[model samples]
Target: MPGKDSKEGKNKNQILADLAMADARRMIQAWTPPVWDEGRRPRISLLRAKKAVPSADGTDLVDWSREERNLGWDMYDKNFFADVVDIEGHHYEVFKFEFIEDISNKMKKALDDLEWVALDG
Candidate 1:
């Protein structure tokens, strides 16, 4: 019972979400995770919201919606809160950027797989 415009909007939203998710993965993978010795700790705060700038041609670019940003932020915050990784004798607070990056990758993968399945079906 959906109207044509409503259906089109839904499709557009889906595409936008997929693109934003992909951008998130790229942002996350661009930086290497910090590896510090037990005596040293990172000084970066991981709780801050970061702006993800996805580079793509105008036709390919999906301007990230507020919902997409919030979704990415939620993933980033979850990783930031669950960060007490121990390496050897060194206890390192996982780099927030790295954590968020990994999360973005995971999200993009999931969304990509879903999009593929939808296309196939």
Candidate 2:
């Protein structure tokens, strides 16, 4: 894991993953939260949250906007490549997902903290 320690020389995914984790850590900025774990590499799971704002007639949200969002696990992938996004049209945005709240803490070690993360949003 020498490469893991020396972040400077890492590839795109590794560097990005480190940055993602760092950003998350900074955002939480709590004395105790979830620290990155290098053991269990996280598996990217697809998530779709529909926009819930109701429209006229009070029917389900319209598909004109699709109201669909794409989100997945942010992690480092050196052995393989992985990316998921929301593609509604020519325009698109990378989606970021918080680790499932209940599992975020306990799942830290279960995630490969050493790997960098990114999303081609």
Candidate 3:
């Protein structure tokens, strides 16, 4: 049988996973894609929070706003390509995707530690 510490660690990781999922759901709900057509109505703001990290320059810092903005753009592309977002009802289908790996082409195999990290609000 596994020890108490091992069980505790697993439980903690599970909690983190649950929290991350919730945050992701909220992000999806809050995002509004830019208007594409004259007849289509624009999306209104709901909620927005970004993910950030410390830059290689240390204190300089890599901001999450950029990444979040990029993610939004990528999402728009995906929607356009897939025709997933509804312009009439403002409803979007929730899809699962990896943050750094799936969205970033150049980032492939570049980010080791952050490969598994999910976007945070």
Candidate 4:
């Protein structure tokens, strides 16, 4: 059986994940593809990691070698392998696969719907 503290922790984690997803959605919606030739638009890449593990203290979130600047968003998923690219072709490894998996099914469906937006660019 799970304890009250454990349940609360899970809820907190879920809330954080939800917020992160919302932020990602907003960014994707607001992003404008760089101007291309008439009738052309740059392709944006949406990538995901194969797996991820939750970190309680974010110790695993730090990438020492990387320059470490905020992309104006947070992954909260802790994914470091796969990357989500912008219309300009910048790569971002923001969300972890496992963290995404833990989110509610409705959120997952919403994310799936966003896939078309990535390709539409």
Candidate 5:
């Protein structure tokens, strides 16, 4: 937020925002009961209203969707991915960029196990 005053500062604001979001999500999941079947086929908030949905991981997805609507798609140049993460009894949007490396490694292990496809040699 310190750099939001200028173009460069604006970028920093985004990065900080992203980091904060990730931390919040981690804090949330840590407290909640662990969900076993994380593939609950959660509902998208944009499509559903008033009803709170459970994610595959059993997190309250409604909160995430609400925040997205609040933030609007245009805020981040319309070129970003939104994710639901929990923090302190609340869920929020955690940009994919916030944990690219961590997610990539996890994905790699999953792909390796599935033999989903051949990795580039």
Candidate 6:
């Protein structure tokens, strides 16, 4: 059985995580692309929250590469490569591919500019 101190610490950690998630949600909601194409735009809500890890140097800085990898994993699990077809019965795999690539680049840019540490549910 854990001590009172341990339980309290866990509760405090949960509270902090909740707060961080809320902040990330707000940032994601506020983010917008320079050129908004509703058809090709990614569903921002699909993005998942990622846990922060310590820097490789054992400093307070975040491990950005790890964060990027986390984002990639989320993107992969979210089916970023899923196929799409137009209403006219035309299949444009290249179009969807380009759109996904563009969105990924934009998202990475946002992550850097916004200093976003995590996302929300």
- Clash pairs detected, candidate 6: none
Backbone N/Cα/C clashes per model: 1, 10, 1, 2, 6, 0
Scored by lDDT, the top model is: 1
TM-score of model 5 vs. true structure: 0.23
- Considering TM-score, which of the candidate structures 1 and 2 is the better prediction for this target? 1
Clashing pairs in 4: 77-96, 79-96
Candidate 2: tens digits of C-alpha lDDT, residues 27-113: 755644244466444445332333332334453222333432331122223322133322221211123244344234333433333
- For every model shown, what is its TM-score relative to the native structure? 0.25, 0.21, 0.26, 0.26, 0.23, 0.24
Error in Å for residue 85 of model 1: 15
What C-alpha lDDT do the candidate models reach, one value each?
Answer: 0.42, 0.37, 0.36, 0.41, 0.41, 0.40
Error of 6 at 35 (Å): 5.5
**What is the RMSD, in Å, between candidate 6 and the native fold over all Cα?**
17.4
Decide which is better by lDDT, 2 or 6. Answer: 6
Position 42, candidate 3: lDDT: 32
lDDT of 6 by residue, 15-113 (tens): 565478678768877875344455454433223223343223352222233345334434434444222221111112222553566556555665554
Name model 4 segments beyond 4 Å from true: 1-10, 35-47, 51-121
Give lDDT for model 3.
0.36
Residue 2 error, candidate 6, Å: 5.8
Greater TM-score among 2 and 5 belongs to 5
TM-score computed on alpha carbons, candidate 1: 0.25
